[model samples]
Target: MTKKTKSLVVVMAVTAMMLAACSGNGNNNGEQATAKPEATGNTNGNAGADKQEEPVTIKVLAQFGRADLTENEKAFFQKVNEALNIDFQLVIPPSSGYAEQLQLTLISGDVPDVVFFPSEQDEMFINAVRDGAVIPINSYLENSENLKNYSYEHSWEALKTMRDDNIYGVPRTSITRNDGFMVRKDWLDKLSIEIPADNEVTLDQFNEILRAFTFDDPDQDGKQDTYGVGSYVDANKVLLPVLVSELGHYGWQKSTDGSYPFMLPEYDAQSDVYKNILLYTQKLYAEGILDPDSPLNDSAAASERFKQGVTGVIRGFAGHVNAQEKVLKEIDPQAELTYLFVKGPEGKVQGTGYGTGIWGVWAVTAESEHPEKAIQAFDYMLSEEGWDYLYNGIEGVDYKLVNNEKVYNPDISRGIATSIMRRHNAPEFFLDPTKFTKEELDRVSPWVDKAVATVVTSMDKGYVPPAAREPQYMDYKLTWDELTTKIMLGDLPIDQLDKARADWYKNGGEQYLKEMNEYIQSLEN
Candidate 1:
């Protein structure tokens, strides 16, 4: 064997040994085995006793957002056992350390029966498939009605693109919705600026409003303390709202040619979209229209500034408007917020679209003795009975139904109850009108309904190519972020963007683009 193959074998052996040493009876948590009722025999005089089949035990390695499951979650699992006749042995590590733990578990050569992958493009997931650790679920999916029906079509397409046109995972679905800018309607009225009809504004009109909010003293405070907009860097370290607007889409831009079918809008050779984004941000910063501390601010801080009435506009989900307005009204009772959807250069309203509408995926491992049963457990979660338990929690314990309305128990905490899996096929799945009174719905539905109705979903929302995870590619991204931030803050000239673009190609971007396009072509085929 070659030296590389020998080395890999040795590493695998060591990982297996380590995993064996760490694992004890395959239960990560010190919970007891799930309880089952005794099977009753026939009371009549029968020749033989009736035997009941034992519940299949499926070991699951999932990531929980919190430290551990709550009592309610444990109860939920019991309900699953009663209905599906399956025992779920869940091994959830801390979410912060889950990625590393997952890598270790996969390399150990003794994987869980069912594993949750946060991203379909996760390197370990791809490697596991290449090594035959994970099995394709296309055949099983054909029979799983709830799983197929509840999940988005794009989610299946995304999974097919991951490797060899095979569906390997059941998607944990999320609502496909876009957030836009929310401005203070009271401030607009105060400035005598007429609110745009249909809550839509042209880019020029939007800029004019920003200038007015900044210089015209819309808040009517004697001092020049207010700014036009609150801004902050997203997880990727890019300034948001403006970035989303300037790019006209999220992630990759679909290309016309077969050779380069998908292009990162920021790195497009033919367009200045990215450069213009930086220039516009710099102008906002120089003119004192954007929050001065934006670079150092996170989402929470920016949102807090908006609530404190320090900024007139902030980016937010439509559902959050009611809460934000409540907070703002505490300071100024007249404060009112409304959603704003601006027309992009193409003369259509644009917002960042979440790709495939999947938050995570659940894959049955090849090591599973009952792969079909494992998938059945997931399908059960999407069923009306299971989803009701997941979404609303135990009917009596978490909430009570009175006059066909759910009145939640104030003491119970079901924070992110559906973290393990979600089923958000429609806006109602997210907003859940049943949970709100008519007055509450009246306050929220206008903004949320409009946001959903007018949203222009991106062409490519959740396509993460394998090349995107490479070390060299990651380094280039960091450099790009740093350069973009510097230019926007005027620490570096806008011309430095050229250098950043050139550095991207030199640092494996050319290869990244080639691989991404190839994958896109594969999806087309």
Candidate 2:
């Protein structure tokens, strides 16, 4: 069978077994476990509430971004063993197929004692809760003051429930900032163009700049080879900064009456908002201002193309500015880069980003023989001392405080230190505050303030898809991708969006709207 077919088969087989396997396990139901003694007797930290004679070994399903563990990871785990007095047997699976793998493993009664999900909102996490694969840890968390203080209240609130008003997991905090655009400041200066203020590019100016970048040989190379913009995986991510400035938030337009414009049939063709965005995209594609390989390019390829001076402006996060600058300097020492927070029609820069909430959560599993001990171990890791170790590694070895500033050790490889730091699967939430200090920020990218300001000013506009209509959302996503790709490629006329909308509704949009609207109502009630 084909790979896709095999994945579907695996999912189906596991799902069928889940209901039967989960129902018999009373421990998996969101219930508080019986009081148990601690594995470590160490109350100095949040290791355990009670006392124990021996160390506890817990199997953990870690949702790692990459498949393999490095030497740094091994060293980090050794430290974890020493600090927490807990042995962790981690099940590391390739992140791409983790959801399917997790389901299959759980259904087969081979689930680990604990599982670290990439996101609390992930469909697999919800299913795991509903299917009784994981137990809620509300009682256990109540025992730890450190875990409570370190956790973001918003993240805790957002991730606690799975339709039963019970806590299922411990959420990691994260910062959400919508992606921004970066351009070569030196190129703008060379062309005698005034740099637009942070997040303040008018459509007219934006187009003009692209034309200059495309035709003016901004790189000072004799050949007119550079494009205005390079490759991006999705149109929404790269173009939303420009579009949301003129129009409101893309995709669903929420009204004051709690209605969604995209869901209503009247706005399907009448609004023409989606069509207009496409037309603009097509214009750039035809004019050779957009990267020709955009439809096929990944973020890495896009960044590489940008570094090679193949494009002048690309959409990315604040960190991309630092990474791109580092590489671009190697190629052309004189190259200078600046980040832009594209302004809306009203001259206000709106940013859509995540707050202090991560996609991953640490959860104790129903099958765990030592559930309370598992919670204690996780809580300990979130303690101040534990967090310090997880975030920086051995103070003088991996990193050190220089003049009261936490600086990475010059001798240690950055890659190794980073790998070690992420060994515990506790994701860093805010990139600026968690990773970058003020002095480091000033040295790395001074324009980050503009982006940060934009993000802070427009925090209310950030959007995440509703989880109520997840299945329908997936179906609609597939249809939307096919429809948008065809329109952008000129294979289908822009006017065909009306037909596309009808197809979407038939596919899943109608049910998605119904379910999402119902969910919104439920939240209000």
Candidate 3:
């Protein structure tokens, strides 16, 4: 159980099954119904003609999005040209600095063949559409055999909202992150407490178990040292379902009236939800049952609490299963942890997907003389060969599937080391779940729960599409995030909840609702 012993064990990556990606250009999650005139329109933006033989290098204008890829990344890029016989000069910057860069590029009349954009509330993309900086790609849809098929097979509603009659770029699809409670099972056995069904314990019931685990001295140290829950406020943990639920609304829950939009209180707090969340917070606050500093702690701090045997419950997404097991094993050599799906206030469960934002978008610049090559390059990314190349660098170099499950070619590690921006799991980006085989999913799953649970498929997964972005509505999102944090932290008077809702209306919350209504109704049409 020493750090030395833990460091010696090579923790494998999370099971690779759940990695999931996009609809098409004009498939923005924005709220709107941009009408289109069918696919038979005239030649728009120089659609392709079969295959072009010219080997011209097209320059792409990508947003500040692509990773600061490590050596593994460079190898993967090389593989694209080696396998697909296509070359592209990807023009991507950092995602954090992308918006400002995109603006300057647009003004300069230099646009990428494809740019990563949110169908909802992305200012740069909207402005580009208004100024004709981006091609209305709906007409281009007809020429795309792969895209047309992908669009029809999947729901087209999201794509429809992003554009009128032209598809601009491809819409990024996402995976619904199916995750749950991260409890150290070895400790549970020590305490002889039954592991709840798929770890689905009710709020009160979960607290009872956590309290026993923490205070009853399950560790047998005979000290009043353990806490019920372990959590942190770091970026990754902030988006987690458990932390998300505590604040209100991480998973998209629907309302009875279907009139009010579902919101994670932090991301989208409904008035009623916020009021109810107070009761839970009040309970934890009063019982001294929760970690007092969870609000300030980051993921590592919270996880450390669990490792130190100071807290019982550690909630996180599915991917953490493997890592959690690895870390906690140092505490108890037999530590085992599994996914626990989160139950909402109503006791119903919901999961989140890969955001339809920057992570999934990749682009080629308009500056390229060979725009056709850019499309081809992107299409190659969607191909099985391209995906495999991305997942692991050039075969026999970065990795080799000895028995089917990929094992890195030890030599590849010499030239490159793994880090945040790059890893062997890169292929999940374009691997089509529709085409995903059980073996493939097992090989590339992002979360450990993929084997135990099937991800829920949904056409309406809180995506508002491109036309959904309105100035007033965006303000509502901003204000809601700001105020909800204040309310959760007890900075705002609890009674101010109603006033906040009204203020929402005054500050265009009402218009936002109306806009959402129109988009929802459009689903019917």
lDDT of each: 0.72, 0.60, 0.49
Q: For residues 258-322, could you state the per-residue lDDT of candidate 1 as single tens digits?
A: 33667766777566777787788888898999989788788999988988888998877878777
List the candidates ranked by lDDT, beginning with the highest.
1, 2, 3
- Where model 2 places Cα greater than 4 Å from the true spot, the runs are 1-53, 65-111, 118-127, 143-162, 172-174, 196-200, 233-246, 250-253, 256-273, 353-358, 380-384, 401-407, 411-440, 443-480, 489-494
TM-score of each: 0.80, 0.71, 0.66
Model 2 worst lDDT window (10 residues) = 26-35
Task: Pull out the clashing pairs in model 1.
Answer: 355-462
Q: Report the error of model 1 at residue 86, Å.
A: 2.4
List model 2 lDDT by residue over 233-327, tens digit each: 65443322124424434323344344452233223555655577677777788788888877777777887888888989987766656667868
Model 1 poorest 10 in a row by lDDT: 41-50
Q: Give the top-scoring candidate (TM-score).
A: 1
**What digit string (tens of lDDT, one per residue) describes model 3 on residues 370-444?**
555555555555455554454445556666667786566543442211111111123353332333455555633
Show where candidate 1 strays beyond 4 Å: 1-52, 65-79, 96-111, 160-162, 235-237, 241-243, 246-251, 256-261, 329-334, 354-356, 392-394, 413-417, 432-437, 449-461, 464-475, 491-503
